[model samples]
Target: MFRRQFLGLGAAVLAFGLSLCGTAGADPLPDLKGRTIVAVTENAYFPLNFTDPKTGEGIGWEYDAMNEIARRLDAKVEWKTSSWDAMIQAVQAGQFDIGMDGISITDERKKQVDFSDPYMVSEQFMLVRANENRFTDAKSFAADPKLFVGAQAGTTNYFVSVSDLLGGDDKSPRLRLFETFGASVQALKVGDVDTVLMDKAGAEGNIAASPDRFKIIGNGLGHDEFGFILKKGSDLLAPVDAALAAMKADGTLKALDKKWFYDYRAAH
Candidate 1:
């Protein structure tokens, strides 16, 4: 029920500005001549790219955004799924034309793949079982000897848990690693771990889905900018960026954000 406000223009003002930029009728987008682009994702990150339980089909913000981009660019997309750990490297090896997993844009990651302009900015938040009251924030959670966090290794969540909450000791016993965010969340649900660090948007979605089972505690921990990954030197980079810019300018991106982050309900 608690939605975090962003540090930018409000939705109505942004939409009005976008409409002015696009004029009334003329299409200014580039045509890709029906080239097929391969897109991959983990499909586990809630409200970004994940399987819909009711439909057994992929759906989320990224899916909608990418599809619209392809439409505007006069291209087609072939979607694929990848494990979270292998996504960047796989894209770097030219296995996929692009990858999306709410991946943060960081200097360390830039070495492997080129990133598009950020689609969304987010922050880390603590997710814990609703009945727990042992600690209200990270500091108190760290002070307790019996508390530990569940996270997927090689993720922003894991790194934040290590650096911000566990004294930068990645090998600390207080950190339990899982193969997927779903696994870590399962661990949290069963009391296997005291908490899980998640992006604020995701935490909000999960909490809204299961209010009695989960709750977010403490202030947001860190800022992150999410972008789509492209192989270095890929020809598709510029076109994808252009399409994204158009989407932003036309308010399509803003509409997708509202649909996924604030309006849609996932079947838990």
Candidate 2:
């Protein structure tokens, strides 16, 4: 399970306001008229994009949002799966028409693929076992060299572990790299690592799924914005952005957030 604390009070306030606000309008845009799009995701990130443990069905906020986007754009989406490490390059190579698995927008990544407008903004937090009490925050965790952090390589979590959570050294041995966020969390569950860094949305989903097993520690590290990825100069970018803008303007985006982030948690 996961827990969350905002990076700052102001951010928390803004998040709350955004959640309750209705969309301003639904402007018309270029429509694909039933063109097919292949979208890929690593079915590992809980609440964003993951296979249901019981049903083995892919489901999450990203799935819901993408479905709505395809509907609005008059497109058909064929879902695909890829490892997180290979997703970017695969998208860049034109193996997939689009990709999304809570990918953060960053300059380094932008060099490889174009990103749609920001869809969601969140902050990173420390995810730890429920009974954890050794150290409360990043500083204390870093002080004890024995305390290890689990993270997936080339992710926001790994970068945060090296730069903010661990010391500014990427080679720090105290950090354990895993192939997926689920694997890192599994390591934490089995006492292989002291903590795993995850965004607030992810943490909440994990915690909701396994409330007794995990908890979040300290305030969040910093802000991050998630977006969809496409091949460089892909013509699909504009229509996709238009769909997203339309969703935001019509309150569909906020409604989805509430359905997945709040209502889904309660139901689960």
Candidate 3:
């Protein structure tokens, strides 16, 4: 997620209004003339996007949001999956028309890919095993030399572990790297790592999955916003943004957040 000011629901709602200001016209929604757009995401980001354990099919907030956007625009979406590490580069290479994996709209990433309006505001939190209580927060965790943090490499989670918890030491031996967020969480489960930094939504999803196994402690660590990614100067940018604005105006976005983050619980 792109680092920014801590935004409540009101601020997130205001962000949608601001995005609408960019496209000047009587109609905020656009029709894609039945065109098919290819969209890609890592099907491992819980609540945002992930495989439903019961059906083994991809489904989450992003899936619903993108499908709704396509419907509103009168377009068809072709879903594809890629590793989180390769998603941005693959989209930039023109392999996908759109990408969404709770991608943060950071200035550095903006240089490589165009981003849609902020869809969700999130904050990083400490996810730890429920039974353990060695450290309560970032500061307490940092004080313990035996503590180790699990994080996916080249992600907001990893950077936050390094910058916020580890005093900007990217090479800290206490940090353990994994290929995916799921993997990092797995490490935490098996005692390979003590904690995992995750967005509040994701942390909640995991906690819901195994309430007796995991819990989030401490206040949020960083303020961030999520947006969909497109290739630099992609032709679909305006239409996608317009559809998002319409969704926000009609309460579709808020409803989706409520469904995936607050209501939906995976069967264990």
Candidate 4:
């Protein structure tokens, strides 16, 4: 299974190099002039897509990448917002031309909507209080029935906690479900839950945003790749995929990763 394969890989095997540049003389993409693409996101996933607290504007890695993709494809982007729970279905129903919110590409989802080439891959980690000492890793935390974990219902983080970290009981009383990822983190902040499972990117973003309040614990639980989502059989898929390939070949993707993941971490 994909989940088992991802979890079994060591950290070294999961690590990626951002320094890799794209190859020279890659094939050019088809011109998409005069096309306008509508994109949707939750704007709640940090580092991927989030509203800037100070500026009150949507900004982050996905926003940057999507803007670049639009520029390269000669298309204008019209941004819209939706709740994470509704995003995939909304896209599948043709309510949006494209959707992105750190969405993981799974075979199940592929049946409803097509995914662009993967834009980012990340690992899951345990986010705990800064002074936490009761448990250091998943196994230790699972052994202690008193310890609670917060995760948004239906998210990969939630399933990971249920199956991979805990004992595969979906109805575990120790699991506290939230409506949003940020809400789960907030639950952890107030000591409502002992920890939360978050992707390494979001964990870093939250830790950077509140270094004195939270910290990541344990090795990464598993790895997952994120991709842009579109309605199945949408005409935009080929051009979007080509744009992503060009960005990968031209080092734009690596540059954005460094800017949002590394440089942003340092500045924040």
Candidate 4's C-alpha runs over 4 A off are: 1-24
Q: Estimate every model's Cα lDDT from 0 to 1.
A: 0.85, 0.84, 0.83, 0.82
What digit string (tens of lDDT, one per residue) describes model 1 on residues 137-241? 989998897999999999999999998889888989999999999899989989999999999889888888677999989999989999999999988888888
Cα-based TM-score, every candidate: 0.90, 0.90, 0.89, 0.90
Q: What are the per-residue Cα lDDT tens digits for candidate 2 across 7-122?
A: 34433533553453333443566779789999999988877788876687788778878987887687899999999999999999999999998898999999999999999997
Model 4: number of backbone collisions:
1
Report the lDDT of model 4 for residue 130.
Answer: 97
lDDT of 4 at 197: 87
Question: Of 3 and 4, which scores higher on TM-score?
Answer: 4
Strongest candidate by lDDT: 1
Name the better of 1 and 4 by lDDT. Answer: 1
Candidate 2, backbone clash total: 4
Residues 1-268 of candidate 3 have per-residue lDDT tens digits of 1111224553465345435532544464676889999999998888888887668888888987898788778899999999999999999999999999988778999999999999998889999999988999999999998999999998888888998889999999999999888999999998999999999888887888767999889999987789999999999999988888777776668766656665565323
Q: Tell me the tens digit of each residue's lDDT in model 4 across 121-144.
A: 877899999999999999999999
Given candidate 3, what's the lDDT at residue 53? 67
Which ranges in model 2 have alpha carbons more than 4 Å from their true place?
A: 1-25
Pairs with steric clashes in candidate 2:
1-206, 1-207, 2-207, 34-74
